[model samples]
Target: MFLGDASTLLSVLNRRLPELGLVRYVCTETSWIESVLFWTDIRVGTSEIVLLQSNITVNYIKRKSDYVHEPISRTGLESIWRKMIELEILAMAFNPYEGMMAKISPTATPFPYRADNLWKIQSYVEDTRYGEKYFDGNFERSVEIKTRVGSGNFFRNEHSFPVKPYFNGQISKIASF
Candidate 1:
């Protein structure tokens, strides 16, 4: 599935809706993996930044028949949300991939999550006759968002800012991510 900025996504979704052939879209909030976490351990002059990684998979079977279940009702949506949460928690707490980490990391070299790598191209300018144009125009391609956990500061790949400022409440590191 293509994941991108919301406004761009809305236009993309509108264009692709015809392909789905569904009369309507059942929009659902991200109840699982709700936010990306930028967890840090505080220190005097510096701190280490590590992005929290938790993954999960959800499978829903027919309760009675093969009909597609439309969770339009609050109760139905709640049930689905709860099931998603349960699966997410199970994966995070147990870390099912732990046992296979050694085998996968050393040998397989699986595709990595490159979301954080976007920081490498925070801002770019192209040569124009009149002046340089910002890649995102005047808008920031990425923006900082509060964590769903509502505690520590977290950032998604889209947000364009350095990681070090959030460490000591000071902008010691002016480097853009």
Candidate 2:
């Protein structure tokens, strides 16, 4: 459930409280919701918790999501279908931001690209070992091309803490997540 570098955490804990004998232990890769559910089950002495833990498997995935302001035309849909067929990847579109999403104020959340969105288009491209050269392998390139063709320009706002330029004279955005 610890969503960070385990070694860094261990080092800090060891420096602060060496007497506690805190050694790093690797936990199964579970989502935050799953971890909370498992913890609750364990706390209540649920009999099926052990079985659930045994079934946990770490999934490696690459996902790109973008909001659409307008509905896609028939030709646009055809283009997307053709691209998916050519690349052998999957793309899905859904409208989950109609009712409640529209009601919420834009300033209410850090996610600024929520309001006035018609639907969301998501692409799932797995980063596999064998296919690491073309198609889904080059995730950034593939996404850039596909998104440009489908939804004009992708709008991914950089949400990072501003930092001074490095010794190499290149400014880097430190990810605060």
Candidate 3:
């Protein structure tokens, strides 16, 4: 899904995250794209004030001489993961939907420090091969680490957040490296 914001998000991740070993082995399949779409409401306690959010899925592929292969690398995939967190953190304050910074309410009140959009991870998987169960663990870890560091704004400009264990749910379903 080539939404208007897709390219912009991809660029941010590539430049900021770079190649690190943060990619979980779970996403090491051949180059693939995951599209995550959802809606979020910025509410006042329980009242819905406004709805705004973004869905970004990353495509992981290996880099070769003047060519890119679908086989994902640990470094390449990790970079994508790092980028996702970075984008989400920015999303808290910036509203891609409106092409402006996010507001605290629909009244156009400027958010103190960019509104923190309440987000949830639905799933990240290779739809062609396996179902939601395949990437469940890795997706969980990704959101956990992102939310943890985002909560503190830790190293916000860089992808240096800590990571947890590998998620290999039903190893039989994943493609071999």
Lowest-scoring 10 consecutive residues by lDDT in candidate 2?
159-168
- On TM-score, the candidate that comes out on top is 2
The sequence of per-residue lDDT tens digits that candidate 3 reaches over residues 26-111 is: 22222112221122221223222222232322222111111122344789768756775654422211113222434345455543
Task: Tell me the lDDT of model 1 at 132.
Answer: 18
Question: Cα RMSDs of all predictions?
Answer: 23.0, 20.2, 18.8
Superposed by TM-score, candidate 3 places the C-alpha of residue 150 at a distance from the truth, in angstroms, of 42
Off by over 4 Å in 2: 1-51, 91-95, 124-177
Tell me the TM-score of each prediction against the true structure. Answer: 0.17, 0.39, 0.18
Among residues 3 or more apart in sequence or in different chains, the pairs in candidate 3 whose N, CA or C atoms overlap within 3 Å are 23-78, 31-70, 92-115, 93-114
lDDT of all predictions: 0.29, 0.49, 0.34
- What is candidate 1's lDDT per residue for 87-160, written digit by digit as tens? 44211111122222324443345544222221111111212111214444422222122211221333333232
Model 2 agreement with the true structure over 1-177: per-residue lDDT tens digits: 345456865776689879877776743545665666564343333347575776432222234466888878989988877776666443353545655577788899986666778767665433322234544557445534443343222233332111121212322221110
Flag regions of model 1 displaced more than 4 Å: 1-39, 43-106, 111-132, 135-164
Which lDDT value does model 2 have at 89? Answer: 43
